[model samples]
Target chain A: MIQNVTLVGAGNVAWHLGAALEDAGLVVDVVYSRNYSNAKALAERLYDAVPTDSLDFSESKSELFILMVSDNVVQQVAEEMTLPSSGAIVVHTSGAVPLEALANAGLYVGVFYPLQTFSKGKKVDFSKISICIDSKSERILDMLAEMAYKLSKKVYHLNSEERRKLHVAAVFACNFTNHMMTIAQEVMESNGMHFEMLEPLVRETVDKAFAIGPDKSQTGPAIRGDSKTIGKHLEELDGKARYQEIYKLVSESIAGIEKE
Target chain B: MIQNVTLVGAGNVAWHLGAALEDAGLVVDVVYSRNYSNAKALAERLYDAVPTDSLDFSESKSELFILMVSDNVVQQVAEEMTLPSSGAIVVHTSGAVPLEALANAGLYVGVFYPLQTFSKGKKVDFSKISICIDSKSERILDMLAEMAYKLSKKVYHLNSEERRKLHVAAVFACNFTNHMMTIAQEVMESNGMHFEMLEPLVRETVDKAFAIGPDKSQTGPAIRGDSKTIGKHLEELDGKARYQEIYKLVSESIAGIEKE
Candidate 1:
């Protein structure tokens, strides 16, 4: 039952968490960022939030401070932040940084990482998003779990080591996967074909991968041992050396795994 | 109205397309495959479908013949099958093959490539699937359109070249993308982590990709220009030379694209 909150940073993560927290019955009283206009822009969206560029929270009444800054700046901002008057539970929404990064910043420090890709102006369904929370203190962990359970049904209590692994895995599963799609889009658009034509196929790929395990759900020439189709594809990508390299490496990797 | 369909090659494509066509009120009368058991297994699910290992269709009263064989065998089977008594429209469900492959085999020939992956046991929703149709004759194209439109709202009349481009793009988008997920799954599972933990992140990645274009939706350490995080990931993957190569290459490619 955290009543008031202070959200740090005005980027995609901050904007999303600020709105979701407010909608979930918590009051986001202050929005802070180094840039004044950005702080004002995000703060304006909340019910009665005040905007400030200063890091001082000495006069604020917010019981929870969420640091939604970039991974590089999380530790710096947490150390520079002037703790609130209320012995507030300060947390960062980063999957990479450990909870010890905020050890000296506040009495009760924790990590509340929302496992979703947030782009500004895009509406995210918080209910479907998973939240990974961690804290050293039992009392803070219980509080973190309660606040997280309000936003999503999926909440995992992962430690620093586990969270880092999760982050690395995400780098492969989500970030790398999206890059593959981007490469496909660039290739198709350059060849005078509509990239959207592959929409149904892309959706079906993801649906199948999750419906069955990725190992069982794999399709295409690489797995089927059809080198003819693979040869045609490689020939097509020959002009683009980078795409050709990726295609060759990944295809050979797939064929290699099948042999095992 | 294409009333009766004589489905050839009772594989994954035939198992799905046959049931979908039957459910759309078209009758599937005969299913032929090199293997009699596979034909029987699929044909038994349809209404009044006769399973046979022979390729002859001279005695069958079918109006449409669909070849659902592999890409390598599609053209060969198209040339080998005996023409049915009713002079049916012969089509192959292959993205790689051209419509002219069936030119000497039947009076009416076309392509009815359903643009989705299919497994024998998995249930597929045909309405969401896209069907790509092509034919030299307007009459055959119209008949193909009539039947395709009944099963799905998305029906594209892409020529052979465009269809080939589509197949190539699918290799990058669907096939390669799923492989990325598979790699991530292997990495996670080998490390004593549950692969399903990445489900929410994967779903969100796809949702964001299609909602906005993939270029704008791309988010990660590489895209964010966070080389330190990328370095950490590479270090984690250093033991697996193949994975390390993939990580370094894809990340460098993403960084290169951003510079461009």
Candidate 2:
């Protein structure tokens, strides 16, 4: 079992994951960032955690090193980290990155990605989130499974390819979903209405989608193929060609028409 | 004030709205549908509502004729209804149709469009939904406002133009949102994974969007301009041109590239 961990970055993921691990009874031994203040700020959140600017963990007694850094730097940071080679486990909290990124950095390298979006200062219920863990060795994987089970109710052993697919799906489900909301807000504000008025509808739609399946919960002119209403909506778009294009293409897709 | 109502359809909106009106102390006098069975099915839910397949309302003592029919039939239903002259108010519960559609049927015509996507057997809290009411005359508008207030807290006097925009926005925020979920679901299921694992991330994404505004809630490779991740994602969608196209266009839009 991994009893202690060193957070290798001070990002939103690092902050949240670090706190959740601490709450799960694991000792967060050190927090490190290129910027010392950021490391110090996050380190201050945990009990008796030290903050460091360097990647050298030669002096610390941490059994695990968790790379909460950006995807671009996951390999770089892993390569730079001072590992003891035998007793330590190195893991990254990235969905886009593969487990092999840290292969040369430590003897036992793995992935500890939580499939959720985190923002600075915002609290997340880690207990409800899905944690996807992957590793080469069975022992390390078992250790990860045990550690993850402590922080969340849902834990799965997903490989690099599966994690990449999940990451892409997340991009659509979360990022594109938010962009759609932004479009709705722009449409409302442009027409002298407040976006807040649509909150109940938005909330209800989401609830209904999950309650029934998403494929079965679909409604509107698009799915119904009410072309007249669709035409009128497109006409209403008038000058905003961008929104009109999206509205048209998405509507077509919903109606099961592609290659047009 | 409108005390009794003649519900002009037996669809999902009519089913939910009829219940809400009765709960708000208004008498649902009649439930009508072209199919007599559908009318009876919904009518059975009310305390004393009569189910009818007839368009004539001359026999009923309903003061408000609420047309909850399909958008294409709103004007046709209004014309077919055997409305009583002068005292009776005619209104259609549609976001697309104008109040003028019911003008020839009665002296008072308006809209009582609740901005919501209702599903049968799925209960919604009416008080949280927005009711967009509009009429040409002040007295009729006030009557609709009074009736709406009893049903919901958020009431807005939106004209037909504004209501159209609101409807389009609903299409994006609700329908398009659900479609995105469907895309994510398909992605997961086809990749040897269950969509339920994504529920936590989906829920958090929505919560964040509403807590902080949607404009400020966007996070992904698209917004970050992470070309490597974007290329990897596009490559993952290989051979699925429809999804690849969407991924490209939406990513470009998020990156603020409208024309190119």
Q: What are the lDDT figures for the candidates, one per model?
A: 0.87, 0.88
- Model 1 residue B197 CA deviation in Å: 2.9
Candidate 1 per-residue lDDT over residues B36-78, each given as its tens digit: 9999998899999999998888888889899999899888898
The true-versus-predicted C-alpha distance at residue B48 of model 2, in Å, is 2.0
* DockQ for candidate 2: 0.74
All models, DockQ values? 0.71, 0.74
- What would the per-residue lDDT of candidate 2 be over residues B74-174, giving only the tens digit for each residue? 98888888876446888999988878888777787999999888887579899999999999999999999999999988999999889999999999999
Q: What is the lDDT of residue A222 in candidate 1?
A: 93
Per-prediction TM-score, please?
0.95, 0.95
